[model samples]
Target: MSARNPGTKLDLQWVSKVRVNTQAVLKRAQQIQGLKTPKKQWQAAWLLKAVTCIDLTTLAGDDTPSNVHRLCLKAVQPIRCDLLKSMDMHNKGVTTAAVCVYPARVPDAVKSLKAANSSLPVASVATGFPAGQTPLETRLQEVRLAVSDGAAEIDIVINRTLAITGQWEALYDEICQFRQACGDAHMKTILAIGELGTFTNVYKASLVAMMAGSDFIKTSTGKETVNATYPVAIVMVRAIRDYYLSTDTSTESLLWLALIKEELGDDWLHPHLFRLEILSSDSLQIYHGTSLSYVSH
Candidate 1:
């Protein structure tokens, strides 16, 4: 389920509104969570990704080198880490800058990061996490601990108690405080796609995250069985695309010195769609402006 494979490509299948309901969201959320103890490998991927980008690390404490654990320990030495380490970041790489984990494991993740490049981002979830049902002070402390432990990025789950209830202003305020707490580190707002449950709601969540002060907006926390599927990601990408198209700045700003090599080619449009977190080759292909060859994953 963790689409961290280099060959992963983006092929989002957008599902319009008129398709999701409160019951559907609640039922699906439960299903994804229950999948943590999957009985099959195929079902494992989606269920696994639903819980972690480093799916293989699920058995971090298991003495035996479980398949998923083996996949994760490779990250101990990124060059030798998971499938993402061997990727060609110079060309066809499809990984987020770093792996995300629980706050308690942030140190291990930090220690596992490329020591030479300490800048590699290590994201951690915070602020009451999935349910977002905790007090503000306690949530902030969780974020503080995560950062102090070396998390380079923070992905705080919004206060769904507020967001889902149409309390946009309250949601905005919480995100604002969370953003401020993040300080220098980048913040990725997790919408917990399971709760959103629909394209329209997903779109609204994306906008809310960005507008409220998210450096990047994410899908589910992976704590849920519903991972960052193509359809889920596309909703955010389109929102990002539409955002930049309506802004004063251009895509050139996201690039290095305006055209690191040649002109914009066919990508002259100013869009935030460029900032995506597609973890699989299948998803990556959807937006492949350039093709790449593979090596051993």
Candidate 2:
């Protein structure tokens, strides 16, 4: 895992200058998705990796502790024991990257993981999740309460009003406050890209979130009509690559970039810097067997 992106000062000029070529993004995404995929054991191995990156989530109006516990159990053993054994991964201690739920359900997830003796982190959606129209003070308090409830990760919703209206500074400041409230817990800033209305806005929001010290810049909240898509992901990862590059200075930066470029192709695409919140298991299965294009991105 690389060091957490300690975000630099917000650069409005850079943010304003950011651009996304939609046609190019679409073409590259298609090319990546069209690549040939692995088969049999190879496919299984990739699916297992997909399982590990999942933020196994359940966010509903009627969620209960029993259901949360069941979700945690599934997170601990995402695949059946026999299936893992067949794949020769039964004793590998495989688990989803984390378990996500409402802020109020954090304790349930923590208790369940503890009872199961599993160390899976509990990720809570806070700051007026799904719809972030609450008062700023209330929203910030929500983050604090979730952290106090034992959430190791906070998935916060950015105020799309600010992004859509071109209020970049307000948006960056708001996210910075949310990041502060997260304290030691990692922050996954949800850009809610679908609602931002343009690829350029999506790209800009991704940069602002990273610049505000977000641990991971996620694509969507799964509440939008359009959730995660390859085109949007490409734009986001490119911004991540740009941010990684910007962190370096002249000669040393060039050396480090070359080293990472060779040693870890698309190294910024890992779970630490990026995450995709999918709506169904079917998409995960498709990503696993058909193409690493979607999975790798």
Top candidate, metric lDDT: 2
Q: RMSD in angstroms, all models?
A: 12.9, 6.8
Stretches of model 1 off by over 4 angstroms after superposition:
1-73, 76-96, 114-119, 251-297
Per TM-score, the best of the predicted structures is: 2
Clash tally for model 2: 0
Clashing pairs in 2: none
lDDT of 1 at 122: 66
User: lDDT (0-100) at residue 168 of candidate 1?
Assistant: 62
The TM-score of candidate 2 is 0.87
